[model samples]
Target: MPPATLSRTEQSYLLDGLRSKPAERADRRDLHEYRMMQVDTDLSLQADGSARVVLGSTEVHCGVKAEIESYDAPHVNVSTDLEFAPWLPPSPRVQVMVEYSPALLHEHNATELAMITDTVQDMLQACYALTGNSIGPLDARQFIVVPYARYWVLHLDVYVMSWSGGNVLDAVFAAAFCAMYQARIPGTKILALDKAAARQDDEVDQDDPAGIKFITRGRKPSSSAALDDAVDFALENEWDHGRLLAGREDVPVCISIYPFEDTYLLDPTLEEETALSSSIAVLASARGHIYGIRQRGSGELTLDAIHKAADVGASYAKQLAQTLQARFV
Candidate 1:
């Protein structure tokens, strides 16, 4: 990119503006308030939860929705709108729907999008486990024996409304935290899974002096055959009728950084983003379990820098988790 022409006074003013903005602090250091700029919330209607987050002009919108599906792939568990369109290919026995829409993927550069999706999935799965059984209110054994294939699905959609270039992944993570915090899952009671289908009428009524029922279920798809069967089942029924469900809890927090020069920028401006040589994002659970780390793109980040980034990510993650948790109160 060619440099823009400016008079000496204009150049001085620009330099002064840049100087007034604090230099990037070391990863382990606390993030200064001035450097962070601003934080905003509330954006989305249809989702169970939603938030529009802004960090120094960089913008990302996040929404959380829940549904029932029989199966899901492990790594791509975030289940954002980005992957909804691709049509799955038809094998000799099955068809895989796959579609390509640049509009969805265009928001973030290609590599960044991949990182964000994976990070969110890991976090949400952790929360899902606390909700109880993987398949539904019933255990896998019950579901397999009876097999009412309806699965509850949670879709967390992230939209990049604006990008000034800084670390979009970090911003994406923050927005996701806010959205998930605002989300809630309805109380659902498990019915008989062995019957192939369960009805709302079969729900154990707590008020009727009858009784209460609840059960447990995330298995990621490993093979095309497995995915096919799951998809076939998901498309075939609707099973969340009478299940005791819990509100959302334990959201995973992510911190992302793009490394440039010897200095590491927390969120790079568009110009810095273009200048970056490499990027790494670290996702941590509230317990400090390092669930995922994605290191890719063209940059050369040193081993030391990588560790430092994790520390930075972990700190910010804790702060994010605390802030979001407060929202629930």
Candidate 2:
């Protein structure tokens, strides 16, 4: 069967509503308003952690799974970007001075993997509030390099089975936070390493790394967190750089927004998403600093709107941070 296509008028109607402001109504309702309820959830026996996020009627389930592998190569530095880039010739001196940026794969699966990797990294940073402003490449110290053999590595997998729009990023972020809070990374003590040895002759014992010290207790994989109150604590202390993250707080709060047409929405639904042509995502810190901004679609944006959107997002985000911190910290 042939696929159905929208007539020009139908497309224009959607475009207009999404891009232009609607006729002013007697009652002034802002462009974006959303309400979400956490409905049902379950544990992932096969995954490190997982959860189901329900935004009103829409539902999305996210799972986190991880494995440790021997570090290979210098430690692959993963970078994230919103749009696809077309290659261009480098300047004469630029090529000589800087490392060539590698070309991204043209395959669908590869592209998807790239996106997944980026999302997982973001999820980790958001959940843990890790230090160092570095992006793209993993730091050398984070990986133990083995030239010809395996090195220790951590891999995180996230699955999005269902989605309804209110902010998949928010849902995914919340889910990932839950999952990581419940995740188990077996604590390890460094074993002695002989200076002059290869894997074949290495004396480092794999069976037990130094000694397995019981620092963080292990828990049976359950559907929910044992420390539910921690979420409240996180909300209280907040994710301020020195204040909350330095062993003082629990969860850091963030606000993100999607821009459509000319009107901006605070939180968008699936119907609104389907009607829009493009979106720009902005994330702000509690201190009113712009952490990240990304334009996800082909939609155009004006500097004025961009400035206004950041202000809007930051305003909402600060409130969220304070609320969460009040509950937790």
Candidate 3:
């Protein structure tokens, strides 16, 4: 469908309907109802994990890629993105990218597109802070190629193929969430090398195929991290497909609400979004824990409105998770 180019007459028609005492949606959905979303996984043969989500006419594709890296690299300036967490000294981290097709330039300027992608990335990073998988000896070791020396840098790329409606961030996050759920990291094994078998390059990785074993040890690995140098690990039977990860339930569901003063809209269309006073996107779990909050539009939001929207979003997230849980199984 072409961009929702509404004339003054069409705009008034929509605003009038929405501004009424009992707001009416053109699609006939309840005031706070979301359209059904269709999700498909394993779409990319090259990606370790991949999923596509369709919410109404908006479509997003998420692919997960990870590379084992050593701790010797420079530290990421995460202070801007996440609060100081001692456990995060040097562990698995995620890189989320929100890329929109160039065709979307017809509807949004370059600055607008960049801002949207940045906001989505921030929202996801906040959510990751809340759900950064359990990394301990007893827990499932995620992204630990070798204890203390190397870890995985998980890359989550979300492509907005098309945006016909509101909820672009919602759809993007949903696709990323599903893709991470489906993602599997390849297993790693330690091969003790004799001094003779090891290469002569002592400055760094000496003939390290995985680049996990460093010639010299630096900072000690965080105890709360995935693995310790002393901890021994090996999979019973590992394959190219990799192993399914745990803590899928830790992933939060993203829900955005468009607020028109006292009225709110869920899953608004492009035209509907245009008439909104403001919008709030919240990342929350089915258990009602709010992870992050982002506000858009120039209009101010009341504290009461923010509270109500968060509550509504959290409630809806539970239902959405329940609806999709079966497919994950």
Candidate 1 regions exceeding 4 Å error are 1-42, 70-148, 190-249, 258-263
Candidate number with the higher lDDT (2 or 3) = 3
| Ordered list by TM-score, greatest first | 3, 1, 2
lDDT of 1 by residue, 16-99 (tens): 433444543323222222245344555555666678777766667777666544433222333531112111111110011111
Candidate topping TM-score: 3
Whichever of 1 and 3 has more lDDT, that candidate is 3
* Deviation in Å, model 2, residue 50 alpha carbon: 2.2
Q: How accurate locally is residue 149 in candidate 2, as Cα lDDT from 0 to 100? A: 27
Cα deviation of 78, candidate 1, in Å:
33
Q: What is the C-alpha lDDT of each candidate?
A: 0.46, 0.39, 0.66
The deviation in Å at residue 138 for candidate 2 is 10
Residues 263-294 of candidate 3 have per-residue lDDT tens digits of 67888887887766578888876566677777
Which portions of model 3 miss their true places by more than 4 Å?
1-5, 73-92, 130-141, 193-241
- Stretches of candidate 2 exceeding 4 Å from the true structure: 1-30, 37-42, 72-152, 164-169, 196-263, 284-291, 318-329
Worst 10 residues of 3 by lDDT: 196-205
**Candidate 2 residues 1-329, lDDT tens each?**
00124466865665555544452211233566546436233367765445565655444455544333432112112233111111111111000000101221322244554564465355345433323421111221222222112222333344444343335555554444344334433323233322222222333234322111210222222322122221110111212111111121223233446665445665555545544555655555455555566565566778887787777877776665454334332
| lDDT rank order | 3, 1, 2
Residue 294 error, candidate 3, Å: 1.7
